[model samples]
Target: MFKEFKNFIMTGNVIDLAVAVILAGAVGLVVNGFVSDIMMPIVGHFAGGLDFADMKIVLDEAVVAADGTVTKPENAVMYGKWVNAIINLITVGFVLFMIVKAYNKTKTPPAPAAPAGPSDNDLLTEIRDLLKK
Candidate 1:
C-alpha cells in the first residue's frame, strides 16, 4: 500500500496536477489584487465615485440608548459587496481566458504528416500499362 501510494504520487499526472494547482493559486492572488486594487478604483472613478462595498439597503436602523451605550446593530442586504464580488469573478475569468489564449499561442502546432506513397494497386496498374505499351 505504501509503494502504491508512492507510485501514485510519483506519476506524471499527479505532478502535473500539483503544479497546475499551485499555478492556479498564484494566478488567483494576482487576479484578485488586480480587480480590487487597480480595477475597482478606476471603475469607481468612472461611475461617479460609486463605492460598491458601501451600497446596502438598511432593513433596521441602529438603536441607541442614553450616552450611546446600548445599541442595536443595523440589518440590511449589502448588495454593493455582491457587485464587487461579481466584478472580481468576471475579472478573474477574463484574466484566465487571456492567459490560456497566450499559452495556446506559444504552443507549436503538430507538423503535418508526410504525404503517403502510392498504393500497391496503383503501382501494379502502372506496371501493367507499361507492359501493354
Candidate 2:
C-alpha cells in the first residue's frame, strides 16, 4: 500500500498538476497586482480620478455617541470592490487566453500518418505478374 501510494504521488500527471497549480497561483498574484496597481490607476485617471474601491452605497449610516468617534460602523454595499474584482477577473482571463494562443502558435503540429500498404489481392496480382515474367 505504501509503495502504491508512493507510485501514485510520483506519477507524471500528479507532478504536472502540482506544478500547474503553483504556476496558476503565481499568475493570479501577478494579474492581481497588475490590475490593482497599473490598470486601475490609468482607468481612474481617465474617469476623473474616481477610486473604484471606495465607491459604495451606504445602507445604514454610522451611529455616533456623545464622543466624536462612531459607536457603530457604517453598513454599506461595496459595489466598487465588486467592479474592481470583475475587472481583475477579465484581465486574468484575457492574459490566460493570450498565453494559450501564444503557446498554440509555438506548438508543432502532428505529422500526417504514412499511407497503408497494398491489399492482399494487389500483392497476389503482383506476384502472379512476376512469375509470368
Candidate 3:
C-alpha cells in the first residue's frame, strides 16, 4: 500500500496538476494586481475618482455612543470589491484566450500519410514476368 501510494504521487498527471495549481495561483495574483493597481486608477479617474473597492450599500448605520464609541453594523452589501474581482476575471480570461489562440496558430499540421506499399498481387505479377523471361 505504501508503494502504491508512492507511485500515485510520482505519476506525471499528479505532478502536472500540482504545477498547474501553482501557476494558476500566481496568475490570479498577477491579475488581481493588474486590476487593483493599474486598471482601477484609470477607471476611477474617468468616473469622477470613484473607488470601486469602497462602493458598498449600508443596510444599517453604525451606532455611536455619547463618548464617540461606535458599534459595528451587522448588515451590509460589499459590491465595490465584487466589481474589482469581476474586472480581474475578465482580464485573466482574455489573456488566457489570447495565449491559447497563439499556441494553436504555431502548431504544425500533421504530415500527410505516406502512400501505401505496392499490393501483393503486383509483386507476384512482376515475379511471374521475370520467371517467363
Per-residue error at 46 for model 2, in Å?
1.3
- Compose the digit string of candidate 2's lDDT tens values, residues 62-122: 9998878999999999999999999999999999999999999999998988898999999
| Alpha-carbon lDDT, every model | 0.93, 0.98, 0.91
TM-score of each: 0.78, 0.85, 0.79
- Tens digits of lDDT, candidate 1, 19-82: 9999999999998889888998899999999888899999998888889865898899999999
TM-score of 2: 0.85
Using lDDT as the measure, the top candidate is 2
lDDT of 3 at 80: 95
RMSD of each: 3.4, 2.6, 3.2
Q: In candidate 3, residue 63 scores what lDDT?
A: 85
Residue 113 C-alpha lDDT in model 1 = 100
Query: What is candidate 1's CA lDDT for residue 48?
Result: 100
Worst 10 residues of 1 by lDDT: 62-71
Candidate whose TM-score is highest: 2
Give the 10-residue window scoring lowest on summed lDDT in candidate 3.
Answer: 67-76
Q: What lDDT score is found at residue 6 in candidate 3?
A: 100
